[model samples]
Target: AVLGQRHEKNFRPIHYASKIITEAELNYTTTEKEMLAVVKVQLNELNELRDQAYENSLIYKEKTNRLHNSNIKDRVFNIGDRILLFNSRLKIFSGKLKSRWSGLFSISYVFPYGTVELSQPDEPSFKVNGHRLKHYFGGDRPKLVVPDLQTFPKDQ
Candidate 1:
């Protein structure tokens, strides 16, 4: 009877231990599922935020393009107009006082898309971009006047 009582005591603990282990396993699986659900929600939110940022960047670029285009001044050229050509080659040298304009060229022909044919006296005519040319306001050269000096009378 004592051996029978001891056996009953050991079996009772083993059964209770198995039940506790199954409960713990169930709790762990539920916690893992909750964690996985939270991670998925966070991932979805991150993707949405990234998409919103991309859209905002595209909008910003479009506004910037429009503002830049609005500020640009259109240059117009016509035939027989005198223009000064900008000397881009002189930009390499450091000379603050030196004038970058080199030509008093006359526009012989005006082409589409900002192309212009320039002509100068005793020089071959060449084509250049209209952007490099500016209207020359100095029309005809001014004549200089010299004052006559008074002569002193010599004594005899």
Candidate 2:
């Protein structure tokens, strides 16, 4: 089994800002008009860069939303430790407390807004709260493994 490092995210910014552009050096020798033109051009470029950044953010957000909305919680599942959603079912209204350990809840009902719902195997549909579903008693069934296989005679 290959285990990787765990990154716990708690609503903290990963890198406050991504791809910061240094302000262009001022050309004092140039005329005011020329300087204004240069400023406009630089400003346009900056606007373009900002737009691209916003677009990238939207894409990232969409992906995150998709992953969160998916019922397959095991894949890309992160609670309070990474990305967070808004409202969810069962225990709706999560306060961005996502963690790897927290996301390991039920295998069913994953959605945005950081809330999940689960269904018990023996029991019918029942809503669970906060990653941890309400505990239920198991059926009193006989063990499938026989006593002979469970314990061998010392004499033999």
lDDT of each: 0.77, 0.45
- lDDT score of residue 32 within candidate 2: 49
| Candidate 2 lDDT tens digits, 37-119 | 55566676899999999999999999999988885554343322222222345355464654212222233555675355544
Off by over 4 Å in 2: 1-30, 71-156
Every model's Cα RMSD, please? 15.7, 22.2
TM-score of each: 0.64, 0.32
Q: What lDDT tens digits, residue by residue, belong to model 1 across residues 8-97? A: 456322111111234544566655644544555567679999999999999999999999999998878888898989999999999999
Candidate 2 residue 154 Cα shift, in angstroms, is 40
